[model samples]
Target: MAVGLVAVGAVVGLEAADRAFPPPLAEAGMVSAEVQDRDGRLLRAFATPDGLWRLRTQARDVDPRFVSMLLAYEDQRFYHHSGVDPRALLRAAFQALTHGRILSGGSTLSMQVARLIEPREARSLGAKLRQVLRALQIERRLSKAEILDLYLTHAPYGGNLEGVRSASLAYFGKEPRRLSLGEAALLVALPQLPERRRPDRNAKLAEAARQRVLDRAAVAAVIGAGEAERAALAPVPATRQALPTLAAHLAEAARRRAPAVMVQRTTVQAPVQARLEALAASAAAKAGPRVSVAIVMADSQSGEILAEVGSAGYLDSARSGWIDMTRVPRSPGSTLKPFIYGLAFEEGLVSQETIIEDRPADFFGYRPRNFDMRYQGDVTIRQALQLSLNVPAIRLLDAVGPSRLMVRFRRAGVRPALPAGEVPGLAIGLGGLGISLRDLVQLYAALANGGRPVQLGDGVEGEPGLVDGAPLIDPVAAWHVADILSGVLPPSGSRRSGIAYKTGTSYGYRDAWSVGYDGRMVIGVWVGRADNGAVPGITGYATAAPILFEAFAKSGVGLTPMPRAPAGAVRLAQAALPPSLRRFSAGPAGLVSARAEDAPLQIVYPPEGAKVELGTDAAGATLPLMLKLQGGRAPYRWLANGKPLTTLSRRRVNPWLPDGAGFSKLTVIDARGRAASVSVFLQE
Candidate 1:
């Protein structure tokens, strides 16, 4: 048989010599190396041109237990045999024939190393002869320990993971020194069928293969029979090291900063990253498999992204492999509206007291509707923002003009994917433009940092810019917007408190978002399908808001109110208005009669106090106030002090004095009978 194989090889060699076939070259001193994190954590690894099939022989520092287990299970006579075991080869061939499959392999560890260093092109008689020759050549040139070291370092365990060093960390989450006898056995069994023995893929089959290793060890006298039995029966402790999604994202981000060949120091806190991953996984499990989620958390002042979850799972997973929903641009929904209204206030285009008509109106070809599909006509700019009114936002956008608004968004660090010549309509205020969740978080971070622009970084050094331009919104305007947004909590509009939040749902419910900021951090969350399918009954308020709240709560991030504007920051009054209502004025006097067509009514006294205290019923009291009128007729509803008087017959009545309990608000209805509001401070 040996002579026949040699004859066949000679014939094949002649045919191959006439062709381009080259003899596999054997080289000395070839080695592959890997870099790992402290605690034997797998950071990265590389393979040589010889490929990843060479016999791995660990350094003397490597645990002897791992080496013992490898030889005991793989080739019992590895130390004594030159390269091949003639008796074992015959037995393996017989077993293969009886099983009618390639269930057993006869290659000794040394032969495997030979094939790895000088790989065969085909699994035929000629290739086998060449492999045998090379194995003998290797045995003559290297010692037993050297051969074992080569085999240990170059074996492919599974996936991109190679070598026992990497496999030890990947599976057992421990160093070879820490591996138990059972774990050592499991690692040894993997080289035979790495895929079938993968812990994450087929844990049961892997355990069975591990048991076989212990049985073979005992039979070969490599381990005592009692020891082998105990090892075989020992429970494999569940791996404690979970692959963190956020950590993976941070690593990817770090890799971008430096090549994979270079080590990167990242700002990722393992505990924080683990918490973020847990929160995202819990949220995703509750959200169901179809809903894709992305979260980005950043430091408001430093603009460093502390945590980011690109998707629920790795991008390579079959179920979650389409688009990277986090990076893809989607309509930011109402999350972008705050910036528009914020820019308006900052630019002096509008003020909290400025009465904007919230009645339904059409712009050219687009008609915008509120989330509830209800019209709230004549709402104050403050109320418009607090309630997230659609019409008021569009009206404000109309007043600011799309061109200038887009410029403000760009300045605020929002890069909307609006096409050239695509007019920014009223819808843009309600997230008509597509933007990424990362951009949304950066924009909110800018708002939290006092209108200072944000720079998106992968925990690397970079200057934070105010989008494409200088600071667009004035500090005072940004402060006011934050102040109003902070009040939109549960029973008000959101379940999150102390957070300047905005919830948005795009048309067709393709995307839902809740982006906001507290005193120190800015958070942006997105929920939807990777395929852009609308999740039934899933709205931004229902999906994204709660996730944001839960994430902040779990992270123990408190919501401290942003600091008040500095002492010198100028607070501009309603000085800059459109020419139509610029002339309309009312003095420091309380609610006076007005017409609806003139201007929607506004209060100018008590400084339009927010969070003012008043008795539940101030039956008869004199309240100092002022009234400014915009377009509209008013048979204004009257309030005694800060309480509403049933009749407007008597403007001043002594019976309206404070009862000294709960707060009171005086609201007036226009002649059009729309709700008009005013507040006054009353000492209890």
Candidate 2:
């Protein structure tokens, strides 16, 4: 009975000790972040705390050949032994006894994992005993593969670099999944005295260590003798190469999203991203310094951001490169014209071939002009949209109402920023409001997706995607817009392709934008100063559109035909059209009775309380002082300082030659004898 009691007491004592001195490796230290592409390729890696690049690696991620060599050199009987090697221990003990000094310390891969998790500075018997105990405990709990994973994750390769993955990338600028013979041997040798034999620091010692590993590998039959000899002669790297910086902005964002997660997978395709980034970098470099570029490519069907280059260079300090341009709100120039025309189609106000007057017209005193300050007179709805005529787009926006367009954008998960205290206006069609590139992409994606634009994001089947059920415009309208855009000419030198795309330039050329989509993908491009500084001679057509075309060629994504015209869509000649559908009229006359009191004509430019400096012509010669009106009838009369300027005939946009610099009252009287006036200081 006493012997039984003693045995039970011993069992209880062991359980208590196990609980008291459990392994200190309950959690790993700050593991370096790993951002992977959709196909499971590394996009980027960030260092851990203490400035170490210790990315957690699994045994599966390592090359089989490297694993074989690692086993042969580091621990011959790793799988057979429990934690410590009895043969090695006895050999070390006998050598120490015979030589009266220690030749080698017996440490198995499992024991090394234990030491790595619970590092001991002192190289003494007590520390060795603790490592053995922890290794035995780990072996009892984890499988052989798990133990190897732990070792591979924690084993030191060189300064601030732990794990084979980190070391492989630092030295070879590639993944450890495919390593050459010399590379495999070098990786196997570095863990022991990592700093002393670091290739970047001491190439000779590193080579010698690698040769030793190769010899051992040959003897163990992990590699043939000839292969080992060839590996021994292979050169060691002299310096560590930088890890990949592709899709840097997105990688950083993913890391921030789950900072504690060792590996973060994103919905990015590495090859496509690499190509787009290269194109953007080349374009930005030729454009100028302090100019950053952003590109966003998404699947129209899925709304997944397949490739996103937030900036041309994430480390470019001169361009404020850290900022994400895709999220920044900027004026989207004529790019929104397609949607405006689509809205008009949806409203049954016009069809593709409907005759629309592109002449200068005033809207309650706000006059719109074509982009080049030249008028094309009357053109078909398709012609105006294809030409990106500002007056026609504004005329359409006026008819549809900017408020309705804003509401549609909201339904598609887009929110355009309006100027403080200002409501949506016809000017918005001319890039007066602010919209992020991503929001613009989402809206366009909706049009490409048959009027239902899902929210733009990075998601897949396992994770819920952001999808909006509401249509941005009717399916027929979206289809008409796509057909027209597809017919627009591709950028110069680019082959004809079936991509429905549009270009835009903000007022003052502060922003240039290009958005295009095939049947499958939507890509948005933005080129501008992050600080909103204007870039000279840069327009969407000249800059952003070409990039869009080149991006498609490099993207390697297959071309998808634009959606066919919906059932209700129609193209008609002016003579065959309904009278109401013949031309778009959005003035006071169109909305109000002719007998109603005529709203007083007003001047939108040369504000009564502001100063204006009319810029000179392209040749630095006399600059025409532009005169614009909003709410006046055709054949309007104007006076400058009570002096007759001219008797304007027909729908007119006239410019007055400023008489030097001084304050002047600019007045205009329409055919109805109703007048509006503004006083301003003009600089010549």
What TM-score, computed on C-alpha atoms, does each candidate reach? 0.55, 0.82
Model 2 regions lying over 4 Å from their true place? 1-15, 27-29, 96-103, 255-257, 459-468, 570-684
Highest-lDDT candidate: 2
Model 1, range 1-684, lDDT digits (tens) per residue? 999999999988865653443323335344433323323233333355645422233656357776777777778788778988786688788998899976667788888877766766867767766766667766766788888777776676766555676677666654566667788888788877777678677778888988888888778777788987788777654442432234565455455555433334444344455576677667767877777778877788777666667776655353273345657898888887787777666544456667766666666556778889998876667788888888777765654445556655666656578645565556678877778888888888888988888786644334433344456566777888887888776423335467778788888988889887888788888988777777777788888888888777776556666777755344344466454333212211112223224554443222345332221212333322222223345355556455575554212111233445445576555566765565655553
C-alpha root-mean-square deviation, candidate 2: 12.0
lDDT of 2 by residue, 1-684 (tens): 999999999989977887787776666555777888888788888877678888888889889999999988878899999998989888888998999998877789988998998889988989988988888878877889999998888889877888998899899988899998999999998988899999989999999999988999899998999998887887899889887777888887777677777777878898999999998889899888988899999887787888888888898898888898988899998988888888778766678877777788788788878779999988989999999998888877765666657656777877788888666677888888889887898889888898886877753212314464557777998989998999999888788888999999998988989999999789999999999999998899888999999888899888888766778766666788865556554432134222222434566445575565544422445445545454446667889999989766433234577778889998888878888888998655
Each model's C-alpha lDDT? 0.64, 0.81
Q: In model 1, which regions exceed 4 Å deviation?
A: 1-165, 174-285, 315-320, 353-355, 362-367, 459-469, 490-497, 555-561, 568-684
Decoy 1 TM-score against native: 0.55
Looking at model 2, which ten-residue stretch has the lowest summed lDDT? 588-597
Clashing pairs in 2: 365-630, 365-631, 366-630
Task: Please give the lDDT score for candidate 1.
Answer: 0.64
